[model samples]
Target: MSTLNKVADVVPELLIGAAVDVVVRGSDSFIGDVLGVESRYAQLGWLAAINVVVWIIESASEYAAGVLWRGLAQGIEHDLRVEAYDHAQHLDLGWHETRPQGTTLATLNDDVNQLERLLDVGFPAILQTVLNVVLVGAVFAVASWQLTLYAFLPIPLIVIGSLVFQRRLEPLYDDVRERVADLSGALSANLSGIATIKSFTAEDRERDRIAGFSIAYRQANLTAIRSSAAFVPLVRMAILAGFTCTLLLGGWQTLDGDLELGLYSVLVFMTQRLLWPLTDVAEVLDLYQRGRASTVRILALLAVPVAVPAGTARLDKPVGGRVELRGVRAGYADGPDVLHGIDMVIPAGETHAIVGSTGAGKSSLLRLVLRFDDPRSGEVLLDGTDVRELDWDSLRGSVGYVAQDIYLFSGSIADNIAYGRPDASQADIEAAAEAAAIADFVASLPEGYGTWVGERGVTLSGGQRQRIALARALLRDPALLVLDEATSAVDNETEAAIQSSLRRAGERCTTLVVAHRLSTVRHPHRIWVLDAGRVIEAGTHDELVAQRGSYAALWAVQTGEATA
Candidate 1:
């Protein structure tokens, strides 16, 4: 289609040359000679008919090229965005923690869009420009090779200038892409923390910080723009020199009877068509550089190896829910081990609680059990099978986890509860909500389960979000239920209600709880007290209290038996 359009585009210049032949030479014209016609009127009529056909072909081929190129660009953009996001989703939690969320988003969105722009618009224009130059140059060569020599003299200058500008713009555009990611990161962080900003009355400070990022982005773009802008004027000058050569040299040859007047006219018009498009090289190069920089970033993201690859082993149905950590030592990337050779076990259908101060490796232990990160040494096992050897779906399917920070997608109350089990019935969803001690509150809302929770469940209180997360986890009917500070946000009454619910839940599944409050762990079947990443005490509440160890001292301070 693009080739056809370029062919059609050059026909008008030839028609102008043919029209000149008809008016000047009459029966001796090229069209009349080709058709064996001897009349001037008949020759003019043929020229008019040819003009209409060429115009139709040009318009039709233009339409086809637009549809095909734009469609291809859109399809590729959609596929790349989806693939990048899916890859990011499977990456290890450690990898995700090392980068900012907004930088990843920029690669998936803004960078992908840049490539689309190049394919949709820049690529087609470049293709047609090359075709135009070839077709038009061929005509000039056949008409008069002497004129072609003079007209093509400026070609080298244009090509060299374009190459020079491209090299300079490459680094500038790369800097531009980095600034874009930085600005996106700043905006995303500010928006997510808008509530904190307002509470601390730091809105102006945040605005100034964002302004700094924006300024850097704008300056980076300006630097590239200045370089790209200079390209067009220099190209136009080269174009002007070529046009003048075609006009003056061809005119002198025609006047001296060395060149045909009809051919001379064709050379003048075709020179403009060929050299003028070269001016657009600047704009095309700009798009090319930006897209090139974007492509590098997108490909880099796709090339990152999946640090925690999935295993091939499948778990047996009706898992026993037994979990064990044997001589485990683990930490985040390149950091000291948070879990220092720890050994622990929780039998099937039992409830175990881990109590500790901040940064005591309570959460780190949960991460290993969940396979978010593999332990540096030893093994984490589920039902006597190593977690690293189990397929992700098989291992994760049997486990349910609620983290310290609850995340609820923007949806209805019932939708959030049914998230883990999308095929769950309304009755089953309500039952899980009841088990989480949140059914009554959801029932009191005017919209009931259909209520909109807003982004991150911001419309609900912290306790409500936590309870909804718990309900979602419970709805999975997992054999191993992991709760990390699940009741930390709720009041005493609500905490007691959740504890009662946990007791019922523990009857059929293994439950692991991590808590800072001693009261929350008092009723568990067993409690492990961790101090500075080491387990110092393990027993039931009464047994630990009687031992007068770390758990006893913590309980004494909580119960007001001693001043800490």
Candidate 2:
């Protein structure tokens, strides 16, 4: 019914178009008779006035419908694109990991545009074509039933042909849409990894990959085009067949005096006016099928279930950031548990670190703390409350996470710093930057805080971006701060600066650090050593190092010892 309301927006145009056909045909018949009569001047004046009035209505209605439909298309496009994006945002990290960014972008942009095109042109064309048939057929039925039969005889064939074309075109259109998504994905990957491609001198390889996707896209479109191209000619032939029958049969009746000349003129004019526009219906139907295919894809994306639903409970007070994981077993889909029966606790305002080798699931533990994914067994708690029972927004608001691979949005430096706290003042922004040891670097830039970071913060070096991300987390002033290899990209001086800042910040909130650089974790209140997804050791840095275990071995490797 909402879709029907959109059709109503163009109803005036449909009505005027049908009315214009009637007026033009009726006036032409009247002109022949008025010229044949004695009072030709008076009749000509009246006919001229009627034609002018109808033309004004036709022109005004066409303009109004065009404007209205475009506005409606833009509004719908905005809503659907936003809704798809918001839904995707709420989905679990695991879900995002399995989906390609380019495919998701194509669904949001290309698919929505397809529907917009249908609204802009296809919907109005269909409505007007329908009005022409029904209204013109009614006018013919009243004048002569035999002529109506001849006029509408080929309509069924046209409809049958349209259906056949639509049926064949649907799968091909679906193929076209899929191929476009594939091409978009390939293009996005190649563009994003252009630096890597150049370093490896693999431009030709990447270009070949993109070319294959492009060729597939072209072939899919060609297949759909081949079928769609056949339709206009078929509709024209159907229109010709109907028009020819009406002309020959009506002309014979008129010459034999079985039908009046004025009626014959009107019938001939209406037949051409009504059925000829059906030729355009082929293009309209093609637009509709393509739009329908795109709609299906968009709806499928919207239908993806949110694996991690948000909780409704709000905290009685602000969270104090005491986090605990109780026998929490979790993993990716169809994979063994990354965190197997892990039981741990971090008291409020404590600083702890987790250090492990590759595939030891160090980062996975932090993800659980953030509730990016729920445990397959047991529960994660925040401040003695199960995280699954806490309001997700409240839980998230009380925690700040800095990932290993920092992603800075395309915006000013101030914008990126204030991303987690949009309403932060300039002083607060500068203070956070200073805390992250990035204030001097920012101030040195000509644009300073106003500097625009290119897409993915390409304007900033890796260490700078990491510092900016830390500043963003600091701006949030969260009760719990999780840093995953936060200083990995920075030089030792910057790392020392960040570590100094963290030492001060850790006194105010719980801090969990996942670091490969042993220097960062050496002073933590406690260190957890992970081996094969299990916590094998937990103690203060000195205790763990003295134990001569996994943590001791890792420290020896980092401290330049010859052997464990």
Q: Which candidate is the best by TM-score?
A: 1
| Segments of candidate 1 deviating more than 4 angstroms | none
lDDT of 1 by residue, 1-564 (tens): 999999999998999998898889989999899999889898889889999999999999999999999999999999999999999999999898889999998999999999999999899989988898799889988988887888887788989998999999999999999999999999988999999999999999999999999999999999999999999999889989999998998999999999889988899999998899988899999999999999999999999999888888887888989999999998888888888888899999999999877888999999999999999999999999999999988899999899999999988998899999999999999999999989999999999999999989999999999999999999999999999999999999999999999899989999999998888888888898887778888999999999999889888988999988
Model 1 gets an lDDT of 0.92
On lDDT, the candidate that comes out on top is 1
Question: What TM-score number comes out for model 1?
Answer: 0.98
Residues forming the 10-long window of minimal summed lDDT in candidate 1: 146-155
TM-score of each: 0.98, 0.93
Per-residue accuracy of model 2 over 1-564 as CA lDDT, tens digit each:
222333333333333433443344553444445455334444545556665665666566667777887999889999999999999899999998888888998999999999999998898778777877777787689778999998998889888888888888889999999999999888887888889999999989888888999999999998888889888888888889889988999999989988766567667778887788788877898899889999999999999999888888876566788989899899998888988999999999999999899989998898889989999998999988888888777799998889998999999999999999999999999999999999999999998999999988998899999999999998898899999999999999999999999988898889999999889888888898898899999999999889998888888888999464
